[model samples]
Every structure is written in structure tokens, then in C-alpha cells.
Target: MLKKTDCCQGVVNRKDKDGNTALHRAAAKNYPQMLKLLLACKADKNVTNQAGLTALDVARGQVNNRESINILGVCSFAGVSTLYKLWQLIVKILTEASTEIFQDMDGISSDDRNALLVILGLLLTATYQAILSPPGGVWQGAVFIVAFFLTLGLLKPFPRGFKTALQVLLAFFAICFQASIYPIIPFYFYVPLVINIFIFLVFVIMMSMCTASRVSKISVMVLGCWLLVGVIYQSFASFGS
Candidate 1:
């Protein structure tokens, strides 16, 4: 048992009389699930048995053990290959964009940097004015400001595990923002604002999953669909009113 402090230290890679580790046994027997679990627990796949066979070597000797082979490290998410690859590609593109957006001035010429800064400053001023005089209502303007804050937070660089802190900060902001909306805005306005906040929360979670080791692509896709529906419904409600 990994939870037992006395044994967990070397238990995962503990070898038997033949010098075969749990990883070797799982691979030789073609137990994909067991192999995946052992790997996830940090099993040493390169550990060789008395016969000089690694887990991968043993897996190769077996018949039709592609799943086990993949579990050993070939395609990381063999079960969800297509969607996983798509998401990985999307993350790569976004990571490159983040690099450009957050890059230091050392790589850019002075004039180029100044020009970019001016453009951003102008956009910020225009955005502020739009929020101040939003067509929908003051509630919509408040939601816009919160959304902008969340977007900037997501784009900025943070150290490992800092995203969780950002999520907490955003949750606190959302709660305070919602509380402030109750008295001044009508019930109809409050509904769309709540939907917008929910959408923002979902967006943050989806982005967080891009860097997380453990992910649920199906759940993320479903949340994306739900947010789309919410946005559509809010649009209709706004136009009909």
C-alpha cells in the first residue's frame, strides 16, 4: 500500500527474487491499467530484471500489447488521442502567444515597443469609455470590467501552482461583484450578469486544465458548450428586452 509510510518509500519499485519490479510484471502480463497506475506512481520503467529485460522490453515480447506499450510512454493519452492532440496543439499556440504578449523589451527595438504601448494605451482608454457608457446597462459594464480583469490575470506570468491562487482571487472578486449588483440593478439584469460570471469561471477552469497533469477533456468540452448556450440565451434576452 502506497499510503503506508513504512513501505511506500521503495514499495512501488520493489523487486522480487528474479529482480522483476511491479512494472515488469504488469507489462509482461499486458495489464495496461496496472502499468498506467504504476507509471503514475513514479515507477522506474528502466529498471531491469535478472534477465536484463526492462518493462518496455517485456511488453514488446508480448502479443498485441500496444496499449501497454503506449502506457509505457508512447502516446501519453492513448485513449483520447484525437482530442488530446487538438488540445495540446491549442495550448502550444497559446503558449507562444503568451510569450510574445508578455515578453521583455530586450528582444524588441525601442520604436516598435513604443508603438505597441501606444496602441495598447489607446485601446485601454476606449475600453474604459465603453464600460462607462455600455449600451446594455450599468450591470453589464460592471461584468465587462470583471471579465477584463480576469483575462489579464490569465495572461500574466505566474510561478508553478499560482493558477490556483489566481482562481481563488477571481472567485472572491466574483462574489463581491455579485453582492454589489443586487440593490442597484433589476432582477433581469442580475441574471445575465450571473451567467457572464459563470462563463468567466468556466473559461478559467478550461485554461487551467491546459497546464494541469490530470485533465478531463470531455468535461471541459461540455463546459464550453454550456457557456456557449448561456451566451446565446443572454443575447436573446438582451435583444428581446
Candidate 2:
């Protein structure tokens, strides 16, 4: 039918009311043969629907449809632009969820707030000790220590100037830590380093946005501890080598 008429050129790109083109419908339905036919007809694979999701995104959301995902993966170029869009989507979702959570905190009882404060204090002490007596006794842990304290300050009711200063200082120390580790990271570890840097940046942004929230403060503390542990393990391995 497509070859007999101008349907391949006209109907292939035409979207329904939901903004899904022929390729989008085929991909969502996991119709590999139809998907191939549509692609052969020059269907646009990147056209987003009303939800601003591409065919690839729709395929991904179908967790049980591995065949569809694999088909879409073969057709799509895993380029930087795709990754950037995915990252933007993730940041948007996290920001919205955190903002909603923070906004709903007014109903918290005094007891719960006190409990959170106690937990934060314990985490602060643990982080301080980890800094003072770092794995392999390396002073590189100082960078993380600075970052931890700056993040801790965010949970407190500090002046606007002071809070802004802490945020800047925290970001600076986190970046410094990444830079310092880069020299020691092996060539094969380049990918891991990039991922670590990305996670650090995300953590910094989240901290900046939800500074006074208990959930954000606890998350930062836990992530800081986990990152420190990884750095320590890597340092020890390097020393052994």
C-alpha cells in the first residue's frame, strides 16, 4: 500500500491527535517489521509526542518490551544531544519532586524535626572523623571535608549571604577534589571519572536548591560518605600498585 501511493511520503510523517507518527506507533507496539517498513519509508524517529517524549523514550518506558527497545536503539544514534536531553529530563523530574517535598514540610511535628536534627549532627560528626583520619592517611580527604561542612551549613538557618557563600564553597571543593583525583586516575578509568564528576555536579545542584530540607541534607551526607569510600578504596589500590 505504501509503495502503491504517496502514503510513504505523506502519511508516514502525519501525526495523530496525540502527535505520534507512524514510527512512534510501530515502536510502541513492538512491531519490528512495521518499524522497519516505516524507517525504510523515511519516517522521523525523533518526533516527540504531546508528552515531549521521542519514540525511543516511549520504547524505554515499556519495560517488558525489550525487543522494541533494541529495535529503537539500533535506529537511533547514541549521540551527545540524546544524552543531554535525557539528563535534562532527569534533572527536571528530580527538581520538581524535591520542591514538592520541601513545600509539604510545614506539617512536620516538632519531635520529627528534632529527630532529624539529631541524625544530621551524628552524620556531621562521622564525616568530620572520616576527614581527620582518612583512608591511607592521605590529606586529599580535606577537600571532601570542606565540602561536607559547607553542605551541613545549608541545613541550618543561616543568613542569605552566608548560605550563598557556603554553596559556592561547596561546589568549589567538590570540583577541586575531582581535579586532584584526575591526575591519579588511570587512562582506563576515564569513563568512571566522567560519571563521578557528573554525579558530583548533580549533587551540588540538588544541595543548592533544597538547602534547608532534611531530606536533601541527609542525601548529601550519605552521598558524600559513599564518594569518600570510593576515593579511599581507589587510593589504597593505587598505593599497592
Best by lDDT: 2
Q: Give per-residue CA lDDT, model 2, range 1-241, as digits (tens).
A: 6654323555687889998887788777878788778777767677677887777888887758787777667746656446756755775676666556455445556676567656654554554454445352224344444445434433444444554455555545554554454454454555455545655665655554553332234445655665666656655655565
- Using all chains and alpha carbons, the TM-scores for the candidates as numbered come to 0.37, 0.31
Name the best candidate (by TM-score).
1
In candidate 1, what are the lDDT values of residues 1-241, reduced to their tens digit?
5642323425797889999999999998999999888877767676668887778878989999999888776533333534644765776675565445434533556566556545544554454444435352443544444444434334223333454454444444434443343334455765767756766664654555433312233434544565566567665766687
**lDDT score at residue 236, model 1, on the 0-100 scale:** 74
Clashes of each: 0, 0
